[model samples]
Target: MNDLRIYIHIPFCKQRCSYCDFVTYDDKSYLMHSYFKALDTEIALNRQYIEKSNITSVFFGGGTPSYPDAKFIKAALNKFDLAEDAEVTIEANPGTVDFEKLSIYREAGINRISFGVQSFENDMLIIMGRIHDRSMAIRNIKDAKKAGFDNISIDLMHGYPLQTEEGFRNSLSSVVDLGVTHVSCYSLKVGEDTPLQSMLDKGLLPEIDDEKDRNMYKAAQGYLQANGYIQYEIANFARPGFQCRHNIGYWVLDEYLGFGAGAHSYYNGRRFSNITVLGEYIRSLNELKLPEDYSETIDMEESIKEFMILGLRMTDGISINVFSQKFNRGLYSVYGNEIKDCIDSGLLISNGEKIKLTQNGLDFANKVFRKFI
Candidate 1:
């Protein structure tokens, strides 16, 4: 059977974070029943395609997956005949989950829990407009552990407004001390239309300097590496075997099916996404139709470019041999000049077996990626 991964987007949250631009509704609890029904319909409609594949991982990502009752989560999982050892993960907010809810999740076949604990510092959390305080974040993590979640990951944000290097380091240290298996440290970016951008525009929040942001990122990379967390991906660090399989699938160009509103899916050489509007998504499912808003099959050139772009995100980089084997053409035959330029500029290194980013390249990854584009 073909290896496959699945993602379910839950677009409900108790409160939206200031920097978030994901499609989510805060006061849409009244739509939960209908949403789940639509979600179930979507899953069932896609069952035939997945039935021939060995489902490896299923991720519940969202506004706040754990904000909903466990029954809703269970209902979603029930639609799939997942592999026995599948890594089922649910994204949760620290303030939205408790011991009871976590226990329900554990009982419902969720083996991994990823908490959106942006920071362990109250001041930082407040500035980010996070719903949970430091205490709540810590308490919920402990609660998740006690509720039988062995594989836990928490997201930490760095380079927030008014954040100092010391503060960012402290946040990393605190999460490391939590004994969690995985850590995803992200630098704060003010998205367009987000409250954070408005804050920056009105001078309510200070802008992050480029040098300071780079320093903060380097600090995380150094600290996490020293503490036995491997930097498998740019922003993700994990203990020796705890890398997020679901996300790794994406970086490796593995096929995945995404369900629910605003979820994107890459499968059968084509990419598609569901409608972002909740009402439309539900209405389409109610009409017994797939709620896809857009889809396109990528041509060979676009596929090759995307493969390189996504593969370069990993620290191990891309294998030239694998690229040639998959594409039926030599990697250097197409991008030999670009590769040589990057190497000469100290952005990439190749041992002739694989080509990967150097430390400086990691610092200026965007510049390196643009070369492939």
Candidate 2:
């Protein structure tokens, strides 16, 4: 059987973060029951695809996956006949989960728990409109550990307009103290039309300092690596054997199916996404039709570009032999000039076996990625 991954989007949350632009709603709890029914219909619609593949991983992500009733989450998971070693993960916000709820998820077959603990700073949390304080974040993680979750990951956000270097450092130290298995540190992006963006527009918040942002990013790499976490992807660090398999599947361009409103899929040589509008999604799925709003066939040329681009996101980069084997074309034949340009600029290093980003490349990765396109 072919290897596959599945992603289920839960678009409900207690409160929306100020900087978030994802397609999630805080006032949609009333639609939770209807949405899961539509989600079940969508999964049933894709039953043939699921039957033919051995699903290796599943992820529940969203506004806050833990915000929903555990039964709905468990009911959705029961639909998949996953691999015995499948890595099932849920993206949880700090205040939305408790010991009993976490234990329910564990019993439902979720093996990995990724907490969206954006920061451990009370001021930062308040500014970001996060409902959880530092204490709550810590307690939730301890609760997850106590619930028998050994493979745990936490997300940290830095470079916000009001985030301080010291606060970021302390946040890193706390993760070490918690002894979680994985970490994903990311820089803040002020989404357009978001509350955070409005604050910037009204001069209520200061503009983020680019230099300080770079320093914080570098610090996370340095600090996390020193603390025994391997920087596997550009933004993700993990202890041994604990890398997020579901996300890695996306990076490597594996075939996967997605469910729920606004979820995306790359299956059957097509890239497509469901309707972002919940009503439309539910309506279409109820009619026994797939709720696709946008789709495109990934041709050879587009596939090559995506492979190189996504592969380069990881620290190990892409393999030359695998590229030739998979695409039946030499990597140099397709990206000879682009590769040379990145290497000449000291952004990428190519040993014949593989080509990966250099330390300098990490900072200017967007520039190097542009060369390939």
> Can you tell me which runs of candidate 2 are displaced by over 4 Å?
none
For 1-373, candidate 1 gives per-residue lDDT tens digits of 9999999999999988888888999988899999999999998898799899999999999989988888999988878888989999999998888899999999989999999998888988877788999889999999999999999999988778888899889888988889999999888877789988998999887887888888999999999999999999889999999999999999989999999999999999999999999999999999999999999998889899989989988999999989998899999999999999999999999999999999999888898889999
Scored by lDDT, model 1 comes in at 0.92
Judged by whole-model lDDT over C-alpha atoms, candidate 2 comes out at 0.93
lDDT tens per residue, model 2, 220-305: 99999999999999899999899999999999999999999999999989999989988888889889999999999999999998
- lDDT of every model, 2 decimals: 0.92, 0.93
Worst 10 residues of 1 by lDDT: 204-213
- Per TM-score, the best of the predicted structures is 2
| Each prediction's number of clashing residue pairs | 0, 0
TM-scores for the candidates: 0.98, 0.99
Give the residue spans of candidate 1 off by over 4 A: none
